[model samples]
Target: MKQSQSHDGSNAQIGAPIPSWKVLIADSQPDQHDAVGRCLASLRHDGRGVECLSAFSAREATALFGQHPDIAVVLMDVGLDGPAAVQRLIEHMDKATATWAGPGLRPRVVLCTRDPDQWPERAAFEATAIDGYVVTAPMATDRLYGAVLSGIRLHASMIAQDSSQKGMARVMVSTAGIFELRSSHHFYFNLLLQINSLFNIVQDSLLFVVGDSAPKDDVARIRAASGRFSALRNQTIAAIEDPRIVSAVREVFQNGRTVQTNEHFAFAIKTRYEVMAVAFIDGALGLSAMERQMIEIFRTKATTAFSNMMLIDELNASQKAAVFALARVAEYKKNLIQGHHKRIERLVSETAREMLQRSFHPEELDEDLVAKVGVASVLADIGMMVVPDQVMHSTRVLDGDSVELIRQHTIVGWEILRDAATMLRGRSILAIAAEVALSHHERMDGSGYPYRLVGDAIPISGRIVSVVDVFDALISDREHREAWTVDAALSWVTEESGRLFDPLVVKAFRTVVARIREAEPDWLATEIASPALAGKITTAKRDLRRMIDRITHLLN
Candidate 1:
């Protein structure tokens, strides 16, 4: 309830990189937007002025905030979206504060209402991070200006003191990448690196993740050492010879409280998954009382981020397991070859990774692209489950109508994936999977399937999967024909070129195919009757010219 100084452009940092502080206004009234915008028109601080954003509805407000993570302050009309909507928005912003890595910043919230009788109860949202409260009735320009300026100041102050928050935010960013880790080795080791970076990176510090002493299915040994002890980055504790450090780790794990001395510091935090994480700092311990308090808070925040990342990985693993089960069900109903979907997944992953490695399509291959494509590729032919058995396996040659009906499988698979739309709405693998399911059959030249989407219109994922899907299907057995030879399959893909595949995608696919041929020429020669080559292909040792030569015989 404290007042803010009237903005006279005195506080703005001159020649700073930022030109303005973005202020988003959420209200349904056309006049209100104009009023707030006009009031702050000339308002400047440190040479920075206010840029007002207007959102007319709750959905609009959600979208605006989602798009503009740099929004410094949000002034909302509680009566328009109502107090309940405002509370939900506040809660969302709370969960999001530690995830942003941009400018080391967080948004400030102010609730405004025209009616005193309809004021939002302070008790309901006080626990949330609302920075100011404004009542419009009998309100003066100075008071309004004070409220808005106060919100911006609060935001600036939060940013100024964001050392700990930014630490937590960086940890969250790494933890977010945890969901995309393709292997457990990378997951745990990368997690250790992230956790160590969250601290002061003390040399001679050691971290011990003690699992259940008893032999259990999930529990495993993990320990890491840094600084003077950098040799133990990915090492276990079984080979330790330093009795003093070993004993210190033991005492901390046993007592489960942070302990420090003139030259040593130790702390333990029990994770949500029932693992004891104990760290012993072996460097300087000159931290004052306040510094120690801040360290403890940082530890708690970092630990929470770790737990949340683990939970997301678990959920993603479970969802993928279920999707794989569904795909297996589809395969069973149609009596398709074993590991049909698995082969396609491996091929898609292999081809996509090659594209990324050689910079064929850099923009499309973000961090999660590998894991997302891996999970989503299995659902590429999931639409086949909905196809009637007669159409799926009719011995007689089908008419145009039946062929078209078969083509509808892509749409059917997409609809099934899209059913979980609410949970997979963003730039996530599940959404990418849904898109691939619907559009993988689409061709570069508008020559293939139900949609006939061309060129870049087909998602990069879809284009990658399309090339993999056809090659896998061609080289695998079916009711109609035996699996084609590897040489024949690659030649067919090459022949299609711009007609059936993205030229760049095909170029990448050819190299991947050549590597597969080099490593396992047997998989290339005969029909792929089983999951014999379900594993990912390793990097090829040969030059690109040799790969072309291996396939040139077939191309001729």
Candidate 2:
């Protein structure tokens, strides 16, 4: 990794070794855009070159976004306004590019406009998502270049994360989604903050949920709401402080139904023991029916998540830590695939639930089975814990001997769960885990290793786990390969249906995947690196074996 130096001690310049970034220029005015492009045509940042893409109008920009998602930065004119303007187009373009259907890139946008007066103000830009901006001033060469370089750096960070910020924003929200609240005011305030951030509700909004009440001695209400309703909190008596709030509360309580508008949304959730929990969101724009529906669906999920979180809180601290430790046990020591177990667990759960809803497999895959599959799948690779780091993290290809040794992990993991008659004596989840660990690698066509059980002989848990386990592995980056897109990975699954997987299970998986992509568009966009290194290492090991065998024959 040493840099070469010239006779005079100056570092030698390499022959175009730096990667090129795709930067698109979107402007209606030919002269302005061309001038900006011409100036920055030869610009380089962090030794990386720039590849320019031109789009004269909003339509062309949209088309280019689909064609080249790898475009790292965009400079668009804002005069088009609304759908046609660069400002609005950036918002729509984020949604369009946030899927694996294309090159899986997230481009940073910089607003460029000829009208100086029309430039976005600091307050507006700070609150919204305009990355950079430039007015049509004469001496803007340095200014524009600075903006573009700054944006390119930001885009680089986004690429490194694989998924864009927009896609991951919902993960936090989803984790907080609980079905019931224990009138925990701390949790309620936090939940309110989540809703506000997710939907971009303003400070002026009156956000509150009234339902079950906690003990007054420990509960801190009214004035301690952190300015959510500062005026209401400051009121001495705290009775009928706001007539608007009173009317809304009364309406929700009386009707016992949900209400919605551009400015408000109300969902009266019935908590455990038939206690009605009235949740209201105010001063948020309704945007569209689809968006509103998305919010409602997330609300339901959040409620469930909340209930689960509460249940977890009730568990002994040691038990909770142990469960989390089990999930993390699959992480590799070196530069290997991280979060593989968790990814498989989530996908398995989703796919199982999706399959259960459909009549394709009928009797076998139901809600109870799906729950078992999810819980069991978490430890699907527990056998890997016993596999040596040499095999798991080997940069070079592993030979048949090594592979065979590593494959024993399935048996090893299952044996630990099943053979441990004392420790795991009556744990249902462990029994399910044992089944998955042993048979998850078994193929539909009897080509899989170990026992090589074929078709339905493979447990449904094993079948579903096999599909998602391979899928997460395929999409995750390895030392040998770049990550494949979600589209590519799923297509590969479809291609392998029946031969390597159950046809009905694959169908169910596809339905689940489609629903997930629909529910969270960003889910479609997240993909990992390829395992090309793994392939190379395997080839190397086999060649070594062949050479050694030939040498032994010569010695004989």
Report the Cα lDDT for residue 278, model 2. 50
TM-score, predicted candidate 1 vs. hidden true structure: 0.56
lDDT of 2 by residue, 1-556 (tens): 1111111212123221334777788876667656776667666765566777778777788788778767788887776543236555666666776655233345878877666566555644764477887775673888888888888888876664443344345645544443343324445556655555665545443334342233223121232233355455423223546655556755765687666654556655443422344555555453343345556666666666555544433332223234334555454332343355566667888888877777657666755566557767877777788777778778798999889988898998889867632453343566778888899999999999669998988888999999988876777666667778888999999999999999888888888888778888776443432355345555545654575555445334
Cα lDDT tens digits, model 1, 1-556, are 1111222333322122444788888888777777777678776754567877788877777778788777788888877656778878876766676676334255778777787567654753564456777776654567678887887787766765665555556656655665555443454555556555555463566666765333333322445566777676545665567776666777777777677765677777566866667777675555544456655765676566556655565566556666666666665555654466776777788888888878877877765786679678888878887778898878789999889889999998888788765576465656777888998999999987777788888889999998988887788777678888778888999999888898888998899888887898765433432333223112221332354454444323
Those runs of model 2 whose alpha carbons end farther than 4 Å from true positions after fitting are 1-321, 334-338, 419-427, 524-556
Best by TM-score: 1
The TM-scores of all predictions, comma-separated, are: 0.56, 0.40
After best superposition, candidate 2 residue 67: deviation in angstroms? 79
